[model samples]
Target: MSTADTTDNAVRELLLVMPRLVGRVKRLPLPEQLRSLDLAPRHLSMLSLLLLDGPLTVSQLAGMLGVAPTTVSLIVSDLSRKGVLVRREDDADRRRRIIDISPDSRPAIAQWLSPGARAWRHALAPLSPAQQRIFVDTLLRYEAAVSTPTRTAPRRG
Candidate 1:
């Protein structure tokens, strides 16, 4: 087979298995620290986003999580009560509340996230720096694409 054929086949195989891989990870048990605090698996995503993007308002987080602002507020309240997150009034807008991860919880979040970092590091070790960046950027782009909502027309009842 030609190189293009081989690449196409590889892409097809990845498309078929990627969802199952994500499903398996989703089904995995939450880290003990999170479980102890009664946070759901979705909280990990919330925590990661807060860690990366810094503090965000309820509306911002709700948009990111694809949920209602009230839902994000509830999650933020839970995390705040458990000391995993802090809710503060936005400086620019007192009416808006910004949610951020607690400083004390950073160590636990880092520890929980380290395994994935290690795995990615190991996988990318053989790649040149430029190739590694490209690969990582491509993955991020793919994630962004999939997370975007489709603009389908409303269906009839």
Candidate 2:
């Protein structure tokens, strides 16, 4: 088979598998404390960042998330009210508030998110660093492509 055919086959396989992968991840059980919060994808992303990278300020989160600081602040405020997150004064910069998963919620969040992390680690472990970079870059490109708005051609009768 030509390289084009091989690439098309790989894309077809991914198209078939991606939905099942997302569905399985979505079906993973949430912790009892988190069940009532109605957490969205945005919340999951924020929580994942905090869980993996430790605490960060709202501006830092905004930068990492590619969103405005006000957006991150709103999420932080909602999660804070739900007892899922804590905001503390940054020692180095007294005016800035550092956001983190509350001690009470940390273990539950970790337990909920760890399986995916472990699975990614297992999948990437055998890859060379350069291979890993390429894989990540490809995924980022895919995300960007999907996120871009597409214009449709006008139809004629």
Candidate 3:
């Protein structure tokens, strides 16, 4: 096959395998500390964001998660009810509420995501520094591509 054809085939294989790999990762049982929380990936994702970015407003989270403010509010409510999240008035704008992952949750959240982290580390351990850098670079580029919103053509009449 031509180089272009070979590259296309490689891309097709990656596209097919990525989701299955993620599904397998997602199927791993939650650590006991996080089990009772009944968290979904979306929940974990928001909490993870908070853990990474500190407190954020509902609108800010909605923007990050690509959902509506009301949707994020519902998510915040559920996490709050479970004691995994805390909502506080923004110091500069009392009218705005900022949602933060409870400090108490940091340990559990870290433990919950640890399995995947370990798996990735194990998989990368044998790679040379150059290979590791290329792998990370590719992933960063892929993330950027997926995060960018594409303009869609209007439906035909």
Candidate 4:
């Protein structure tokens, strides 16, 4: 195969792998929520994504959540009314609006998605310092590879 063909195959592989990986990882939280909690998995997730990716528009949130923009807008509006996310209009553009996470909501996000934060804390108690370092390095390498951009048609900046 030509170099372009090889790159295309690799890109296809990544596209195939991404949804599986995301599906596996994304389901972890929904079932873990306690019976009495007010926040559904989707609400926690929207908050978590906002925390991780920074503030975003409804369209952007829809892309990340794999939902329609109308769905995202409803969720954002609900969160905004509840004061978990604060809505603000762009001063420069006036037309663009954004939803920012409220300061009071930070603790809720930590409770929801603390990264591998809990597991790492537990591992630290049992593993030697060197073993901990090795595990962390391996995890970081996996993260870097997954985060790298995949082959795609070129876009003009």
Candidate 5:
């Protein structure tokens, strides 16, 4: 097969598999504490970052999340109110607040999120650092393409 054919085949397989993969992830059980908070995708992203990177400031989270500081603050505030997150003074910078998962809620959040993390580790373990970078970059490009709006051609009668 030509290179074009190979690329098209890979794309076709990904299109078929992506939805099922997302569906399985969505079906993962939410812990009882989190279930009542009415969490959204944004919340999941924030929580995942904290779980992986430890505590971070609102500006740092906003930069990573591609959102404004106010937006991150709102999310932090809401999660804090729900007992899922905590904000404390940053030791290095007395004025800055560091956000992290609350001790009370950490286990539940870990329980809910760890399975997916482990699955990713398993899938990526065999890859060399370069291969992992390529894989991550490809997914980032795919996300950008899907997120951008496109105009469709007009139809004729």
Candidate 6:
């Protein structure tokens, strides 16, 4: 077999695997502890975004989530009810409230995320130390690329 054919086959394999990886990421139970809390999907999304991006204004959240500002407000209200989010008045603009993650939820986030971390550790454990490092590094890069805001195109529906 020609070298170019091998390269093409490898690329095809990666294309096939990409969707499976994405499906798994979307299914992660990052807030399992609060699942019985019966929080809305939008509320949990707001908390996860804050955990990733730090505190942000409602406008920023709207932009990141590709939803209207009012939609973000509704989500924030739910999160507050769930005790996962808090409202902070912006000092520079007292009329504008900045949403922030609740301090109590931080520990919960860490604890809930530990399982995924351990899973990755186990998955990569069989590789040699150098190979494991490279594999882990590649996964980090893939995560950053996948999670970047620009990667989420607006839904047509």
Alpha-carbon lDDT, every model: 0.83, 0.96, 0.87, 0.74, 0.96, 0.79
What lDDT does candidate 4 reach at residue 129? 89
- lDDT by residue for model 5 over 1-157, one digit each (tens)? 9999999999999999999999999999999877889999999999999999999999999999999999999999999999899999999999999999999999999999999999999999999999999999999999999999999999999
* lDDT of candidate 4 over 1-157, digit per residue (tens): 8999998998799789868877865665533323244566688668777877888877778888889988888888877777678878867667877777888776656665775446547758798989889877976786788799889889899
lDDT of 6 by residue, 33-96 (tens): 6667666556656666777678899999999888999999988887788787889999999988
- Where does candidate 3 stray beyond 4 Å? 1-4, 114-157
**What's the C-alpha lDDT at position 112 in model 3?**
71
C-alpha RMSD values across all candidates: 6.3, 1.5, 6.0, 11.6, 1.2, 8.7
Query: After TM-score superposition, what is the CA distance of residue 49 in candidate 3 from its true location, in Å?
Result: 1.0
Candidate 1 residue-wise lDDT at 135: 93
Backbone clashes under 3 angstroms, per model: 0, 0, 0, 0, 0, 0
Error of 6 at 70 (Å): 1.0
**Is candidate 3 or 4 superior in TM-score?**
3
Task: Please list all clashing residue pairs in model 6, or write none if there are none.
Answer: none
Best by lDDT: 5
Clashes in model 1: which pairs? Answer: none
lDDT of 4 at 46: 83
What would the TM-score be for candidate 2 when compared with the true structure?
0.94
Q: What is the TM-score of each candidate against the true structure?
A: 0.60, 0.94, 0.67, 0.49, 0.95, 0.56
Candidate 2, residues 33-132: lDDT per residue as tens digits?
7899999999999999998899999999999999999999999999999999999999999999999999999999999999999999999999999999
- Where model 2 places Cα greater than 4 Å from the true spot, the runs are 153-157
User: Which stretches of model 5 miss by more than 4 angstroms?
Assistant: none
Candidates ranked by lDDT, best first?
Answer: 5, 2, 3, 1, 6, 4
lDDT of 6 at 140: 80
Best by TM-score: 5
- Evaluated at residue 147, the lDDT of candidate 1 is 100
